[model samples]
Target: MPPSLPPRRKSNTGVIVTVTLVAVLAVVGALTTVLVVMDDKKSNSVADSGYNYESQAPTPTRTYDPGPSSEAITPTQPPSAASSTPRATTRTTTTSTPSGPRPVLKTKDNPLFLGENGTNVVTCNLPKWQSTPTAAQAFFTAALPCLEAAWQPVMQRANLPYQRPKLVFPSGKRWSSGCGDVTEGEAAAFYCPPDGAIYMPFEGLNVQANKNMIGSYLSVFAHEFGHHIQALSGAMKAAYQQAYEVGPDTAAGLEISRREELQAQCFSGMWFAAAWNGKGSITDTVVRDMLEDGYQRGDDNNPSAPRDHGKRQNYGAWQKQGYEKNRTYQCNTYLAPASSVS
Candidate 1:
């Protein structure tokens, strides 16, 4: 296939920007996330979980030790997951809420309900599958049009203004952009709201995941896009404020972070389902890989890691909850039982 003429640029003239910063909840490297103010005036750098962003470098100055207080992590429950069909599994309790205000979903009335048979399902027009950077870049190139068809209605339904986010897939062990450059393993893939773009370096999948399964890689892309959904919905701002109100690593703050991360998972599942059902290339095998990938990424899988994201069971459940159930309401971790969210 050949390239098409450039699409028109979207205007960000009067959209309000906030001082809050946030990112996908995980720890591969430094985990110091840089976020954008709601306004595009400038992007702000902040740690992924903690309030501030110290300088970033290829060499990690700080240990991944978020902190210590006997909230030692739970083990990663093995995923009995296979294909798109989900299985019921037991969940583990990991956090105890100290007496404080719990985080709430910012918008009670959102128009993001897309069920299995819902409207606006868009089939992806992906290029021939290959494990190379050029192939992956072309994959996203085709995927974005489908994304626009599937997600724009979600924003419009909520009566919020929407715009296409920027995209970049730099090739190297290190690169710098709207978000500061840290070295490899610090981040595999992440969304920076300030720059309004999704950053996907080649190593994100090729090295970090150590496997070249396209389905799993696409899930990462969709997850980051899910963050874009949050930024556009104002949910990111509310969650950031809530996290700041309570310390980011505290029990409350971690729960808020988990809910945020889990919601992103749910959103990823939602979009994937729509694309798959609408003649997308996600096969049953790809669905299995996606689950296995989610299982491995669970925070509880790593004992020394922070439980900023939920355990494997909950992580798998929330994703399945979105895919199997299809409704956004079912994906609301903020309003869920702490046990389910944990």
Candidate 2:
């Protein structure tokens, strides 16, 4: 060999540079992993539940029709009525607590969810229940003004459109309505959104089961009124559109129906709370009976019943929650988990 110019001096530069590059790469990779994890958590917080904390009305891309949705009652029949009308009365002013309660703007945004949890003590002096069809109509008619008294102010405060729902007492077992023709046994009562009418057929009320307990009938009527509230607040339209888009009989559609029905139950409880202990026949006994009736009206109570009205426990649970809380925010079924509604 020509003899190396000199023994090659050991150099740490290559080793040091290689180690530095490896360390830099490791740090960069760790940072990237951390960022990916944070982004995943942020994205899934609301998406997993399919809801958001936006306080805006639901936006529907197209018109939808919620056919004559029915609230079935106990299996029994009563007499028939040819006609009925809400008794006319002077408007009553409602007083609420100052600094109105704000709605819990969490899951679903609705106008009725916007107003104060009103504390207006209603004075509903109802007629005694009678088995005859005419007497039944008279009793229901008398209660109409009372219901209007209770809800008008609430609607006004919520900034929702308010109008007295039209009333009818069909005489036969089959009758036609704005929504469609309805068989007597199909439902005890139903609300027709197109015409804003509540069709209460005497034959469908199943009054024979609770002839003396007028509160039972009142609860039924109030549940229908709850649908009216949904209609006025745009909640009904939004829910119906979703169901229509996903096939009303599908699992998702049924879940949506449960939410609407359960909310109605809560609304009925609210009415009972407001009308309880008032200047009327609504006594402790009557309210208790109403609550019991709610407990019995769950889907699980009836075999062959569709699961659109929630299970037994949840059914009464929501009603009791509303009756005790007496706050609309407490009645937000849309915010509840799927398990709760199911």
Provide C-alpha RMSD values for all models, in order: 15.3, 27.3
- Global lDDT of each model? 0.50, 0.50
Candidate 1 — what's its lDDT? Answer: 0.50
**CA-RMSD of model 1:** 15.3
lDDT tens digits, residues 1-342, model 1? 111111222212211111111111221222222211010111111112211222322111111222211211211221121322221122345455333222223532233322212214566767766778887788887887777776777565444557898888878866676546745445556677667777776655543333446656666676667777777665666776777789777999778776766676666666655665555576555555554444334554345555566654555455544554444555556666677656
User: Tens-digit lDDT track for model 2 on 226-262?
Assistant: 7677666667767777766797569997788767766
Segments in model 1 whose C-alpha atoms lie over 4 Å from true places: 1-119, 207-212
Model 2 segments beyond 4 Å from truth?
Answer: 1-107
Clashing pairs in 2: none
